[model samples]
Target: MSKFFTYLALGLLWLLHWLPLPAFVAIGRGLGWLLFWLAAPRRKVVRINLKLCFPHLSEAERERLAKDHFAMVARSFLERSILWFAPEARIRRLVRFKNQERFDALVGQPVILLAPHFVGLDWGGARIAMSYDCASMYAHQKNPILDKWLLHGRTRFGDQQLLSRQDGVRGIARALKAHRPFYYLPDMDYGPRDSIFVPFFGVQTATISGLPRLATLGRATVLPVVTRALPNGAGYEVEFGEPWTDYPTDDLEADTRRMNAEIERWVLTMPEQYYWVHKRFKTRPPGEPRIY
Candidate 1:
């Protein structure tokens, strides 16, 4: 049954992939409009997230932002077919990199590409893998068929290694030490273990401390990378920032806080593009009420 559904979904994606970029953009927006109304639970989640993060915004402003966010999320979903199945040349043309030399200098060196949960994140990862042998971890989808397809799509270019989350830190560290940059997605809520409550948008958010630990273990430099979805189906731009100078300091908690703070800065630049539909504040501190 799972395989049947997975294939059915993939067939729809393949058909959508054949549409012109602009046409699909319109279709994706229409899908988002439907989802915003139909997926009431998810819409509520997005609303709560935006309210928590941007308290200064009026209710109307937050709602507008939520609507835009849903549109971007939907576009990213519909565009996955292009990222996963389109010709390599088409994918390359659709993604542009800024300050790529910063990334180029890190090749063959132990590095951690710290990517946040932005809408265009996969495009950034795909762009990086086009030139570098990188490693990253992924959570397995419930459907085995979809999981297999995702793994294949991500690793089809270059010598990319996508480890399962169950593979643990040791696996990722080993890959990084082997000179494969870890395309680390460090901004999700994965519970309290190995995580500390840090100030994210002034909220005590649970953030993972593994980033600094992994950097220390691999003796790697940490570089921040951000990808933005250009307006009007223009394309995506992946920007690689300078490597952190004094990261992974003696204070692990402080390092984790810094990580969250940096992500907050980026989110401020484009609030709608950040992954707000997620229950980021899902795991609350002891005795605190649930935000969701």
Candidate 2:
């Protein structure tokens, strides 16, 4: 039954891909509002995240932001059908690169493509995968069938290498030395083991120090990769921001904080598209209470 349901959901998504792009925006907004009401736990999480990050925003403003965020989340989920099954030409049509020459200029050198958790993050990664054989890591999903599909869709183009989390930093280091652009997703609360309590949006959030550590280990340059799901049905922009000059300095914590700071700046531009639904502040300081 689980397998059957998985296929059924995929089938629905496949059908959804055939619709006009505007329909995704409209349908996603309606579906997102429905989910905003129905998915209580997630709505709470989003609310908490927004409150922590945007402390200045009023209750009603955050309330509206949360609803709008769900719409982008739903739109991203629904658009996976287009990403997974659509032709290369169609996918290319939907996703474009800004400052692409900068990305191209980095060819043959190791780079850490630092992508943060935006609703359009996956689309940006997919855009990169369409052209380059990038390497990135993933936590394995519990369902084997779904896991297979996830990987299949991710690696369909560019022969990209999606290493399992267990592969560890060794896998990433090797990929970097190979001169492949490492498609790295940096800002996430992956617990407190290898993470340090860094100031994210002025909140002491558990942020992974892997970005600096890996860059230092791999001797790679760090590039900020941001994706904006353009308003309406125009398309998505996978923008490669200017490379950091003095990154991975002696201070690991400070480096990670810089990463968080950059992400926070970008998040302000499109607050709704940021991945606020995640329990980013779930891991608190030793004496501190949980934020979620």
Against the unseen true structure, what C-alpha lDDT does each candidate score?
0.89, 0.89
Model 1 lDDT at residue 2: 67
Off by over 4 Å in 1: none
Q: Can you write out model 2's per-residue Cα lDDT over 1-292, one digit (the tens) per residue? A: 4999989988898898788777899999999999999999999999998888889999999999999999999998998888878888888998889999888888899999999899988888888998888999887788887787788778888879888888888899899999989999878888988999989888898898999999999999999999999989788999989998898899988898899999988898899999988898889999997676
Go through the candidates in order and give the C-alpha RMSD of each one to the true structure: 1.1, 1.0
Scanning candidate 1 in windows of ten residues, the lowest lDDT window is 16-25
Residue range 6-38, candidate 1, lDDT tens digits: 799999998888776777678878888899999
Q: Check candidate 1 and list the clashing pairs.
A: none
Q: Each model's TM-score, in the order given?
A: 0.97, 0.98
